[model samples]
Target: MPRAPRTRRSKYRALSSLALLALAAGAVTACSDNDSASDHSASSSAPSSASPGTGKVAKAKLHMVDNGGHRLAFYVTRGSASTIVLDSGGGEYSSQWKDIAPKLHTATGATVITYDRAGLGKSDVVPGPWKVESAVSDLKAGLGQLGVTKDVTLVSHSQAGEIANCLAKDNPEMLSGAVLVDANLPQFFTDEEIPRLVAATQPEVDAAKKDPEKPENRQLISTAEGFAAAHKAFHEVTWPNSVPATVLVSEKTPFAGSPEDAQRWRDAAASFAQEAPNRTLVTAKGTSHEVPTERPDVVLKAIEDMFAAQH
Candidate 1:
């Protein structure tokens, strides 16, 4: 309940560097599908093939489950006792866990679940702007259908952290712990700061808008919608104090922003960790924002720590 420490591993200097960093980092193209709000009724039946680039389609470990009438694809690493659910960032499929899932399983012997969100990979494309509520619902429904109703640890990256937060908030008893890898936190960006932050992502937005036909572009659009939704959703929610959590902030790979912006990033991460009853911040070095890909060991260790805390 005491004021959380100002935990940081970097330094900040000026707003000029911040502005330039804002420009260079915030250059993602500005684009959104206005029709994403429309809900399409896709068949909830699971598909036999894995989504493209969702790693090897090992049938024995593959699952297609109905998450509120929409079929979602999941790749599982079967283990006894605990189940670690890997939630990828925006624009990524379950394959993003390719480098870490096996290692996690080997290290902890916990069942690892990684899957594509509604419209990614081999999953059916129903609608756009996958809201945080919908995302969390899908995850919970998938787990329920798989008969995994207990002893779960959520491991989330980037925007997917919103879903993890929602799950942890509403279903503390359902989760053993949570690990956020270079994730977006609740209310981390202020209104005045939002525009500046959006500016930095302009390049990514532009690229997606330029090529509607490209799969990458489509995926980017889907990811963008999820980001937009998170921006609004995180403000309305609160994290529960009961669930144990760890937030891994990447020090080597700073966000594309000024030193000041970087400081904000670190401070936000620290704030997220400080809010919960049992939470810690780990400054991950020698890695970029893609810490799961670059430093799977950090993620694995975090998962291990979370499980240990529960027992």
Candidate 2:
């Protein structure tokens, strides 16, 4: 088949980039190494009730796990019984949950875990497109190494929702429940929607290409490379009814400026929740896509309720 006109192709690409840019709005701003030291201090200083009668904060332990050839960093705060795994959004790493992780640990008395995904934070970058299977494998391997095999409460944000869905479907036995914070729901990736998102994100992808060496750009490139195909397949993903989930949709969604897109986002969340009896949808009032940051109390309460329900 003959290729389309260059102008038309470029137009489509620019649209695709805009969609991805909306999805990854704040991600670029957090692409610095400055969070590393501060994250450590925050985790260490945050009060934890895990230690009975001692009144001392729980120390967070760092573990380097090998995935194929590269290494992924996992941070753990020791607690009892259940384990809560916090996954970050697109173009972000483990430090995205630095504040919430420690607080969750203290509130629930459950072992809280956070980790840097491949090519982000302290994890070794693997050249190539971002793949959800690889992401799921990394998380599973790290959890296995840590002996965290059961009773897991997965707290995922934005892009990590894809990882959480796959984990819940593929390894239902490993997770008891989940809390999705302003996340990307598979319901949003319909045949028509996928093309729109890809087209919208094209401009951002093009800009990232100019500065390929930057950490955020690298992530954007990898993610954009597979966005259309990945989401097309993602549209077919079904969340298992066995694993209960709480879906939190921001009042002003990731595409707040675009009314049509914003309504679609909200509708998708409602659709996902309606699909299963075990799923519950909650709106994060007065917040944007950065729900965890804007309303940590809501995120905390949701996770706490989910954890408590499991027991």
- Per-model TM against the reference: 0.76, 0.85
Tell me how far candidate 2 lies from the true structure as C-alpha RMSD in angstroms.
9.6
Q: Give the Cα error of residue 46 in candidate 2, in Å.
A: 9.6
For model 2, the stretches where C-alpha displacement exceeds 4 angstroms are: 1-53
lDDT of 1 by residue, 1-311 (tens): 12112220111111111111111112132211111121322233222233223444322267777654567777776666678899986656787777677666666666778888877787777555445556777787778766677889889887677677767777778888889888766656555555665566556556657775455455455445434333543545567887778989888434544676677777888888877669999988877666787777788888888877776
Q: Candidate 2 — number of clashing residue pairs?
A: 18
Off by over 4 Å in 1: 1-60, 225-233, 252-254
- Candidate 2: TM-score? 0.85
Write candidate 2's Cα lDDT for 68-187 as tens digits: 767788888888878999998776667677778877877778899888898877788988777676778788878877788899999998888878877787788989999998887788
Query: Which candidate gets the maximum lDDT versus the true structure?
Result: 2
Per-model CA lDDT versus the true structure: 0.63, 0.74
